[model samples]
Target chain A: MQVEGLSINLATIREQCGFAEAVDVCLKHGITAIAPWRDQVAAIGLDEAARIVHSNGLKLTGLCRGGFFPAADALGREKALDDNRRAIDEAAALGADCLVLVVGGLPDGSKDIDRARRMVEEGIAAVLPHARAAQVPLAIEPLHPMYAADRACVNTLGQALDICEALGAGVGVAIDVYHVWWDPDLAKQIARAGRMKAILAHHICDWLVPTKDMLTDRGMMGDGVIDLKGIRGMIEAAGFLGAQEVEIFSADNWWKRPAEEVIATCVERFRSCC
Target chain B: MQVEGLSINLATIREQCGFAEAVDVCLKHGITAIAPWRDQVAAIGLDEAARIVHSNGLKLTGLCRGGFFPAADALGREKALDDNRRAIDEAAALGADCLVLVVGGLPDGSKDIDRARRMVEEGIAAVLPHARAAQVPLAIEPLHPMYAADRACVNTLGQALDICEALGAGVGVAIDVYHVWWDPDLAKQIARAGRMKAILAHHICDWLVPTKDMLTDRGMMGDGVIDLKGIRGMIEAAGFLGAQEVEIFSADNWWKRPAEEVIATCVERFRSCC
Candidate 1:
């Protein structure tokens, strides 16, 4: 019953259960691998969270996030860098495989994406040493283009690779199907990431046709329009045999369901669709 | 005073007025160029709409759309091709510069984006001879990636240009800033588009920070995070001197405002921001 090469990013059941309870549900369903958000870890206190994770002998696929470097002023930018350093420390303590970073988008009242991108590069460079010292690899998760204004400006695999190349060894990419399934250059970029050995994580979810909400409303594995097997094939070809982390942020449907049902469904979908 | 080199895509005020009224407002504001949707033309009858345009010598920047090729079955695909041929004829009748194609996304119940993209290319190729005979160019509008699932699978300038190159002449690209702004390779691709003379239309709209709705939360030119002047400079540098067509789909905000105010703001933003 062990679901080989599969991990549940706890955000899928964040609304239904806390960190400890979500882990219990995952364990019940034979899912020993997981990725947890910073807030989720903080809620249970990092020490207790680490203790539970260690005692259960669970595989920590990745830590939820740490990036949003663009800011309007010097002080704001410095604050973001400081926060990312703390996240690096947390990832190290948890023994997570990598620290996923959703690089921030445009600053307030700013139309200059190029400048914001430059700020992102600078912020990452500033934190690289600390992340390396903590033995945590930084995974830049390029968001969908729709989130380019408010969520994350890094919106392409190639772009993320470019940053990885610039930042050198400590940085890599988190390839999420929800954000990148439509990319025409997906095959080429995955190959590039593989050549550079920059693919750190693989995230899975389907893109609903009538995506009712931009931030949420993500479909479960087999329910929508993503070629999960095809993307996984690409990732596997790229030499990443890591867990396919399920990270659905559904507000109306999945979030309202019981935590047990959600985990059960994830296990079923992982076996059947993914 | 006339806002030089500016065009209004009538969808900006589609909720407030019909073809004649929208035209009247545009003319009153000294705007000589406009792009009207097929529905707006059909609502007032194409003959009347054509008559109005001829009487006032209005410049039809580009027809408001014609593409959605992916279909569940052969019948649907054939119907889409037939409809595109009609759209080409209509664009020719209106003396529009080109028939803009929002090339359709994945067929219903399928997750094969590559197949959907092929359908789009074939659909365009099928209609090319007719478009050439009618003396109307086909402009493939690369919609934002956010629309890749249900609207259009062709979501990047490079992808659109690849289709153009493969299909040969009488085909080009419509460079909408709202769609292409987040592309890291935008400048390079715009330059590539220029060298190939593939730039047919330049649509302008701001990307709001907190985009409330995926399909309709488009912001006005100066109101969001897009660098209008910067993108315009790139397009102009790429040898596209056509009017910067303002197209916004703001259902909750701008659509609720008075038609005159919306047009006035468009003109103002067109002057200052773009």
Candidate 2:
């Protein structure tokens, strides 16, 4: 009864469950793969979290996030790098497949996105060696262009791949359907990621037609316009057979539902739609 | 004294004025250039609108807009093409420089963006003859990727240019700062557009950091993160010296203000920021 290719990014059920409870809920549903946020792991203590993950033989598809590289000053940039190093350590301890990086956007009151982009590249190159030493691959999660100003400047699969190619080893990309499904160059870039051997993780979620909130209003898989099956085919063709991690930041809808119901829906959608 | 290089997209003050009234406000502020929507022209009758434009000696930067090509069925697509033809005629009547095309997104219940894009191309091809005959240029306004599902599938300058190259002349691009500011490949593509002589209309608007709503909530010129002067410089360097048409769709902020104040602010911001 195991859910073969389905993994739950803990954020999908973070509203209803903590690290331990969320794992318990996933275990109840026969989903043995997960990607947990750093705060969720910290709340239960990394040791206990690691124990739970190891005891259940859970697959840590990825650690939720790590990068926010661009900063207004050098001290702030150094602080981000230090924080990223800690995140890498935590990912290594959790036996994660990769550490997902939502690279930061423009510095406060700054209008130059080009400069911010350069800082992201430099920050990644700086910490990449540590990530390599820790045996944890860094997955650059290219956020949608909507988030290009405040959240993450890297907004395309091809852009992320460029950074990956520049950094050489210990770096790749996390292909999330919600952020990239709208890209015209999606198929071409996905193929390019495959050829570069840089696709680390695949995340699944739907983009609602009337996306009410810019940050939170993500739809559950099969509820929105994304061609999940088609994208999966492209990813598979690109030679990435990893779990399709379900990550929904639905503040109004999914977050309001019971964790059990949410997991069940994800399971149902994985079978029927995705 | 006419505002030398500034133009007002009537939608900026849409909630405040009708077609004739909007033109009056623009003329009163010494803003002789304006872009009016099809509905606005229809409100006062096209003949009357044309009479006003000719009498006042106003420059019509573009007629807003014409493309919503992708549809659920063939009949729907034909209807869209027919509508676009009417829009072109409207632009011709207004003596507008170009008919801006906001190429439509996925059809209802459809998930294939590639197919939607093809429909957009075919839809443009269907209308090209009419547009050419009417002597109205087609400016494909590549909307932000956020609108790719429900508004426009053409979400990048490069993508729009590719379609223009395939279709040949009478079709170019409307470079909107709000849409393309986040693009990493923006500079390169703008240069390419220059090389192809494809830059038609240059639209100016800022992208708010915490963009509250996807459709509305657009920032006025100096109010947000977009480097207006920098982008304008790029456009100018790329051989486009068209008026920077001010287009804001803020349901809450600018729309609630008096049309005079909005026009004054646009004039001020165009001077200082852009």
Candidate 3:
């Protein structure tokens, strides 16, 4: 039977297959919803990728990403804006629900996070008009604080919501369980996001007790220490009923498995665990 | 000249020297403050440690730590409480300013962070009377979110303050730069902690761009991205003028250096960076 609410982010099977093959695997498992990274869409050519997505009637819950605003200089920042615009355009072309953003972090040799944060706001405002015109929402993914220095300056949902309120429109937040599961004010912030109508996507993954890696060592849903179902309940109560996109960057275990087997496990765990 | 308002957490060079040797190294550099771990103190005997501190008039900013409240069973939890009482007595014997609490994470194999946090509060409340009679304050060190699963559940100063508010007396927080430097509401929360008179200690260390190991790969001050002077300005503005305790858990780098060399570096970095 098709899992109605399950959406597979293409990165889960990116190593096993390319854009076309990953989609076929998801379809075989009856997961019609998917979120694809910009690279995956770019590799197969956006035209063919769009054709496959359209013909199959896939629900693009979100485009994998479109934010990395901080830079060392004006030229570097402009380059970032140019790339974000391209990502926004890709989301628009795919008819994706939103463009997920992993907003950038500190510039090289700089400890001024406050300045970096201001740059993020400025960069978002710069691309927001283009995103709005294309009718693609911007989803700010507040990564875990572990990533605050090198990956994202926006490290909390409340911080992201504050940005959303400041930006006013065409912007919201993506609440990923992996990135935000440890937040002390998670419940309060989820409710606050719902009230602001600022929750754009909900990503799911487990945080391993002995997480072996800082980057690509994500655990499969039921294999780690996250209360996934409880968080989903909070998200649902907060008014987001969108697909629960499974986004895992497990470099060793899942990446080496058969694409079909990984999808099957996700479906099983989503049913039993989440 | 003696370095006033500077303290060395012996763990900075734990791999190099024993407790007495470490204190000797600090004293050689005209450093008069130190925070030693329970194991280090036990290795040298508390009586000798106390005698050394009294002879030299050393300031014990804090006793290393004494909390791991979550356990799978009540017996396990009771065992933890027993250990904590002993830690309190030891801190009292040393006449340390406070007992730092790392607090524990989810009980083994459990995904329930909420339960772990509740256990932390209950454990503190249970131990508050003992700490009070012994005249030792309990400083809740809110660890970085990366350590949330295994080290601490309290990940923000605001959350730490919430627990302090609920617990009422003999409880505060250790604002470590490596842990809380990324908090979006850092300035606001520091001010709030100051208002509550719950700012027990202030620890200093840098957050490296590529933090290698989660537990032991901390950077020395002036070597990473934390805005030390800025944070110090905030702490001072918030009315906290305690020793800027140096706590580095560097396994490969600082740990391998000579004790005197490490102490000298700390002294130089503390004066220049912090």
Q: Of the candidates shown, which would achieve the greatest TM-score relative to the real structure?
A: 2
Of 2 and 3, which scores higher on DockQ?
2
Best by DockQ: 2
lDDT of 2 by residue, A177-260 (tens): 999999988999999999998999999999899889988999999899999999999999999999999999999999999999
Q: What is the DockQ of each candidate?
A: 0.90, 0.92, 0.81
lDDT of 3 at B183: 95
Better of 1 and 3 by DockQ: 1
Model 3 residue B274 CA deviation (Å) reads 0.7
Which sections of candidate 2 miss by over 4 Å? Answer: none
lDDT of 3 by residue, A210-259 (tens): 99888888999999999999999999999999999999998988999999
Q: Give the per-residue lDDT digits (tens) of candidate 1, residues B237-256.
A: 99999999999999999999
Report the lDDT of model 3 for residue A197.
Answer: 87
Candidate whose lDDT is highest: 2
Docking quality (DockQ) of candidate 1: 0.90
Instruction: In candidate 2, list every pair of residues with a backbone clash.
Output: none
Q: List clashing residue pairs in candidate 1.
A: none
Candidate number that wins on lDDT, 2 or 3: 2
What TM-score applies to chain A of candidate 1?
A: 0.99
